[model samples]
Target: MKLLYLSYLNSFKGLSREVWWLALVTLINRAGTMVIPFLSLYLTQDRGFSLEDVGTIMSCFGLGSLAGTWLGGKLTDRIGYYKVMVWSLFLTGVLFIWLQMLESFYAICSGIFVLMVIADSFRPATYVAMSAYSKHENKTRSVTLIRLAINLGFSAGPAIGGVIIASVGYFGLFWIDGVTCLLAALLLLLVLNPKKAKELDQVKNEAPRSAYSDYPYLLFIGAMVLLGLIFVQYFSTVPLFYSEMRSLSEVGIGLLLAMNGFIIFVFEMPLIKYLETSTLSRTSLMIIGLAMTTFSFFFLTIGTWTGLLVIGMILMTLGEMITFPFSSAFAMDRSRSGRQGEYMALYNIAFSISHIFAHNGGMVSIANFGYKSTWYLAMIIGVMGILLLYALRYRLQTSRKK
Candidate 1:
């Protein structure tokens, strides 16, 4: 029986030791992301801030991420992934500790901006590491595994965070998050070193390509930005809608969000494999995903947690599972060997841009139009995403046939 168990482990052996280490590092880093899932609530409930203030603060984080994504990408190309990952992880840990000490709202907002910049800047390093470390045949699976690690951490973090917030308070959550980040940094510093470190200097000296030069890549990035705009509402407005508007408990809200992560964990891999062979192109999957996500919001307009709400959440997760990884894989496939960092960096930019719109515009929509109307607006955006994907599909197909 023990031999059988060991054999099972060896059968799924595409992940190298370095890749496993990176996954562990990702898990630890993401465990600290407990702060993000509940950040809006923390700002409003614990910190005694208004929704607008929360939106502004969150937008600052997004703005920082915008800069970080670009810088991290550029640096990854210049210095290689190892040094960038080590420093980024350590600096992000330091920022988290500093964030826990701030009492003033303005200070917290500023800290958030700086923290996001440092934290997000690490992503390109991580992705570049994954791209470099994994074999071509395993690339999609490797990226999915990395995301799986993140979602698994997310799954545990928020559920535990909710309990901690209810029992020991937000400071306890912050302390736990800080410790996890520190531990993650230490692990990365110890175990992983890029094999291509010697080539970094030569690569850095090479002329840079304009981000605009890759129009297809830019289109995909634009699609992701649109997706992020719609998706950010899950973090920003969904909790508010459930708690303030629909009158659900915090625990209930936490469970709903947890369900989202859990679904991703359970289905993402199998779904990815199934979709990999399907005639449905990446663009088509994205359109379907976005349409499902948009339609999911329609039930929210009714202000009831009927079976429809559960179904909507499932659809949203399914859409996400299809779109997000495929988008990343597509970008990586199109990128030049040395410019992987730049391509992934541009890809990460979508999330930051989305956060900016979602927090700022989403909050305003909720305040003025109420939860139902705001969902409708999100649905409209999702529809636009569908149209955008359809338009891009022809371009993608044409490129592939060449």
Candidate 2:
């Protein structure tokens, strides 16, 4: 037992204090994300809103996220990561508190829209700080560790949310989520104030800006937007699929999500080490992950057993483990120094846009083509993404030889 404890302590010996603080802050923030996965259910079931109304509200959030992504990146470059994060957290907490008090559909929609903007603004700032802090050797690991922290919180948050909702309902969940946000903000302010001299220098060295510019960056942003649309089905449709099949209880779904977190926490570090030696680039891993996620949906359509669902969830988690870090790392690598915040913000837009598309598309697809067909559609998108990556690989290889 002593040996085990010492081994665990030794494992974290090489991580910087900043990384540790960031990881802790992420955990605090994610613990509050218990509200996200179940937000749709809360709106429809408890708050007495229609599915269409829920979609409308979420779409509003997506729109806000679109603006927030650009704003976040720009702000991070101008004001620094610490400042942006502080305000983002404080505003997000206030918004969550406001959300708890809302009664009407319009009020809920408006409140959530504003909250999403504030909540999302922190994303690019956090990523920029992480990228700036990491060395090339440990960059992937650093990003993966951050992801691991998120998965850890994600693992617990929903299960806790389930119990809270069952016992005290949606308002309780909101209250807890708001309180955690404030705590996370405080932690960020106290513990993670890394230097930003390099970031400031990068901004000063950039060329004069054109209002009509940002086109090349926008192209990558567009691709990420499509990718987000394809990926959002996992959160929005997958659970609904399982629920419809009557294969898992609410607690069971929470457990499955927790399993995803555990897999990442336990395996991501070693997996990153192994992949580092492989010929595969970050883009290649993303393609592979997408393919696996697409394939998992097929299993979902065919099997209703708990065991099969678990297997499918494992595959999806594996895909997530591969794609998320690689995508973030690759996006950061492509970004210019001063523009890191904007690049990361663009990357986040993909997620927001995808969420809206998936919710709307999934509903239509499920109604018309059934759940199996919806999975097939996701498979098709995965294929397209793979093809795009392959084309990119060829272009890169050809250019290198020249």
TM-score of each: 0.83, 0.84
* 277-383 per-residue lDDT for model 2 (tens digits): 68888778877887777677777767456788888888888887787878778766666533667677767867777765767888799899988888888888777
Where does model 1 exceed 4 Å of error? 1-13, 36-56, 101-107, 159-175, 195-208, 242-252, 301-305, 370-372, 400-402
1-402 in candidate 1: lDDT tens per residue? 786556445433665667777898999889777888888888888888998888788778778899899899889877877878888878887777778788788898889988888888899888877766666656666777899998888777887889999999888877777788888888877777444222211223266565568776677777778888989888778888778766778887878878888887766776676676688766777778777777878777764655666777788888888778777766666564337678889888888778766766888887787877888788878877777777788787787899
The TM-score between candidate 1 and the true structure equals 0.83
- TM-score for candidate 2: 0.84
Model 1, residue pairs in steric clash: none
Top candidate (TM-score): 2
| Candidate 2: count of backbone clashes, pairs at least 3 residues apart or interchain | 2
